[model samples]
Target: MTTTIRSVETFRLRVPRDNGAPTERFRAAPRVRSIYPTADELLLVRIATDDHVGWGEALAPASPEAPGALIDEVFAPFLVGVDIAAGARPLTRRLQQTGRERGHLSGIQADAIAAVDIALWDLFGQVTALPVKTLLGGANVDAVPVYMSEVNGASAHAKAATAALLYERGMERFKVHLVGPPEIALAEYDVVRSEVGTSRLALDAHWVHGAGDARRLARGLDERGAWFLEAPLAPEDVDGHVRLAAYSGTSIAIGEAMRHRFEFAQWAGAGAMAIAQPDLGRTGITEAISIATIMGAHHIPLAPHHSMASGIAYAAALHVSAAVDDLLAVEWGPRIAERSDSFLDVAFLEPIGTSGAWIEGGVVAVPAGAGLGIHVDEEAVRRLAAG
Candidate 1:
């Protein structure tokens, strides 16, 4: 009879990209050696209390089945029948502990925990009739400034044209995803910068460079006044990042691949990165806030990374971004935002009484309802899950 989590459900979705065929989605990412998923793929979790339901998602850009299976085989059993009032963070810590002996502290295990953690926070908010931001203390900003994540196009001129289009759409900040060789990246940077006209440009090297090459690219980005140079070196090269941070004029940004505060703490303590970017879909709200606190202690600003997330996780990111004091901006993917409402019955926000999240004047207002503020269409999600 006690109010508790009555059930937990997980879904793996692989929706094709609107712009291209799914087979083409696996092409090697530009400027980086790794193959990136171009489709909208993610793992979702739904946690229901006696009277309300809450939703969450994980950043499973590819092979969502990994986290999906983990949730079913390991995480879901512990969540079912749990009291909703225990709170998200405590419950999340317990879940982490439950999996600790099995060596599940990181990787896809973190992604599974991330989904459950977000669902717990969303469930907690609904049970309390409070927004997630209020539950995270209180918001420091009503609307968080956003930056368009990548300027897309096969050619530098084409990419600049895309940047110009975004500029016309009121986007004031943008990051370009560049491929190798300092000169090639710099040349593309020049074209995109020209079109955007000094509107706070950033660059992502996709962790392809060694320290020497990264330092060379960092100097070029610095000369052009880049807001930050992200993932310039390989992900494991913490020492390399530290050395680059010491030598480069541009700020070094990292953390999207990282899943917890402990990892971020190491980066912060070593002065390895100047900016920290935690994806809520990867860390969930509980740990994202923890990462933010750790970064804040080091006076490192947070700019959360977002990619291939549905509306639920997108709302979670915005709520966390609003609550943080050291927010620089939330990475906004227009294509993702455009397709986010496919599984939601309600729009992510109430602008003009419509039910979708949109960027206007370069910012996204925090969603206004309890929990994540969006109603998940379980039927739609299930339909997609069947495929």
Candidate 2:
């Protein structure tokens, strides 16, 4: 069945989570507040073929409406009548060309392009009857390791409670997002470590600290015997990262803001980060696989980042991690598990023994079956869109 790209339809699907309650930490960031009231804010992209339909979602901006606008106003027009077989490269090239004169690649445009790239890959997977991981070159290991990401909250207790629940669910490896002052953040980590033990803990500063602060915090985390310290300094401060990475005993993890393989090459060659954390949604499969190769040459491990985007992004990350020989683990957010499953058709084959959660052994088995090996619940997506 030869499939011709008919038209690309983009829309916003807002499904409510927690009965419109403000239970999640990052939900109130003003940009995502409306989504809190609505439950879910997904940017949906539909790729139609003569005999099949493919669906994809964007990571969406903090703003409830930006993702949809990005797709409809910018991406959809450029992609509507294109050939899907050309794959993501052509679409990405067009996006780069359109944004070339804009001087930066860090806003709605990147997000929109990412959405289209993901949808195209899903379409490609469906067309070929192969999982995306196999399409990217198959897996070194059947499953990728998973590290639980923290829930944003005001208090250490709240964060600790969330961590404890995940621990009980069988996740031995964990990373917490530190939002407050350095001391406060340290205390939060201490509490979590006390509960989950030091060996399983890692801290993500989210580029929140300066060089000096990052150096100090990295040292502190090392003293606690934590596995690694992630994105402690600002994204562009390569020198700062190099210096901190040099002085700190804990391994440094960075690279989610980096969009292409060259940026990752620079960081990996410079020995700036011990673990490279590229986002599949932001980098797409092409650049991500390239980045993984570059990291492999330097003996650095690739640990792809997965945020609150839809399952497509998560599946894309899984595929990349599965293909990389030097992959360590993939990051997973519990919030996504709690809220996104209903809208996705084939959920991430639960990790084995976590009771509806990705298995806790740190390794996630590559999904089997065709095309991302998952399906979208179109009805549920449409319901959210209607709301």
Worst 10 residues of 1 by lDDT: 349-358
The TM-score, computed over Cα atoms with residue i paired to residue i, of candidate 2 is 0.87
Residue 246 Cα positional deviation in candidate 1, in Å, after optimal superposition: 0.4
Clashes of each: 3, 16
Candidate 1 backbone clash number: 3
Candidate 1 has an lDDT of 0.84
**lDDT for position 365 in model 1:** 79
- All candidates' lDDT scores? 0.84, 0.73
On lDDT, the candidate that comes out on top is 1
Question: How far is 250's C-alpha from truth in model 1 (Å)?
Answer: 0.6
**How large is the C-alpha RMSD of every model relative to the true structure?**
2.8, 3.6
Candidate 1 lDDT over residue span 1-113, tens digit each? 35598899988887776665555656675556666677778788999987988899998887788998988887788888889886899989888887676655578888888
Residues 115-183 of candidate 2: C-alpha lDDT, one tens digit per residue? 777777778888877777777776777777888775445677887888777676667888887745567
Worst 10 residues of 2 by lDDT: 28-37
**The candidate that achieves the highest TM-score relative to the unseen native structure:** 1
